[model samples]
Target: MTPSRELWVVLETLHDVTYFTPEARAANESAGLRGFWRGYVATRAAPLGAAGLGLVTAVFHNFAPSFLARSLPSVWEKVSPERALAARLEGAVAALRAHLPEPPARANELLRRAMDGLCWDGRPLGAANAVLPWPDEPTAALWHAATALREHRGDGHVAVLVSEGVSGLEAHVLRDAADGSRELIMPNRGWTDEQWTDAERNLWARGLLDGGGLTDEGNRLREHIEHRTDALATYDLTEAEFAELDGQLRPAARVLVPGAVPHPNPVGTPRP
Candidate 1:
């Protein structure tokens, strides 16, 4: 199996591993136990046509155009169901929220933890993109600070991280300052040392930043626990329910599997 596309994992709710093509599903059926399990998971879950398509669009909008050009078309061919989900991320998030059987408390915590992880991981579209009270203010300040640092000295560290991927907040700041340029390594964004300090301090204060990094510690916590919590909360899957799911679920199994074909799982799937 080839290395699976990141988009496929993100777009898990759309289709089964064979991309749900008649031929693929048939191949999956022939794969015996593995295919049976895959089909079982897909059949048990509800379809997410609109939501899946909406998510694809959201990804295209958020990612760099060139990157999307290389990735999206291929992903469309492999997992076309997800194309529609692109238009529905926001609405899908809402609908999934309502339909999920988890308790309100768990839902909130899971979301927070997930966002925190994104912030800490320093990737574009991570927790930093999450909406808070003030929008333009913090981001603008951070951008100014980063730019100043870049011009004054050359802290390509931040630039590298942003290029490698920083929180969506970082991307937005870079974009705003660079006038829509996606060149994260460029020193085109603007800011001062003080402003950068302020932004870092703000994130630190928010429990989303620490140890000189942007992501919160909570985000990297074990997915099993988070998934269990979410399953318990939204899906009304209790601890036992989670336990059952855990038994059947493989955590990054494909990564460890030899000869596993690289492709997206069905939509609504979480990273495992």
Candidate 2:
């Protein structure tokens, strides 16, 4: 993997623990956001401060609109955005503390440096997360930094897809074809069979797909998108800085992979 993609694997693992851990689920439930999807939508969108459905759909850039509609505006009624944000942070910290009692202080410091003065234009999710008050505890701070940086990368990824003329469903279809994980992706993203078939037909028409796999052109496009995303996510960190941060975080990721964060999962993070 490229240095930037490798960095994303570890950072995404750290940020994702919040969504999978029982502690996070309970926290969201206690805050009145019940069910996995409800908690998922609320916590992720909470950073946007009561974002509307249209805003969430635009920024998130994936997920069936109807799927998101099930939990969005209604979730705000159950719990305020402020409460959802607090619940997610609390749950993430709790989950992290279970696996890592002592925080990686140096890693957190480097992350903060990387995120400082980041350009927020066209990266709303990352920008919103970056501006949140840093938690007092070291573990919470680490998770917070990971969350912000990952979202920064994710926002850039969405831009790449948009520029490539890949719709939300088409993006997933291409990803599944490339990774051979359609079963997991399609259901989780809430795309119906008809929708998936239509997307596949569209890709076939564009010569990006054939017989449930990416064509050579499709692979090239996917690679270009990934390469551009890595560049956009690079920020100002020097090679040495990235190497040091990787060294600090890789150990925790090793422990978390396929444990705290499952492979072949909906988030599309591969095993590092």
Best candidate according to TM-score: 2
lDDT of each candidate versus the true structure: 0.30, 0.87
**Residue 264 error, candidate 1, Å:** 15
Tens digits of per-residue lDDT for model 2 on 1-272?
Answer: 77878888889999998888888988888999888888999999999998888999999888998889998788888999999999999898888888887876599888888888477788999999999999878899999999999999999999999999999899988888876677987777788999999999999999999875889999999999989998888756788988888888988877777667777667877665
What would the per-residue lDDT of candidate 1 be over residues 46-72, giving only the tens digit for each residue? 122212323433422232233223333
TM per model? 0.26, 0.96
Model 2 — which ten-residue stretch has the worst lDDT?
263-272
**Model 2 residue 214 lDDT?**
88
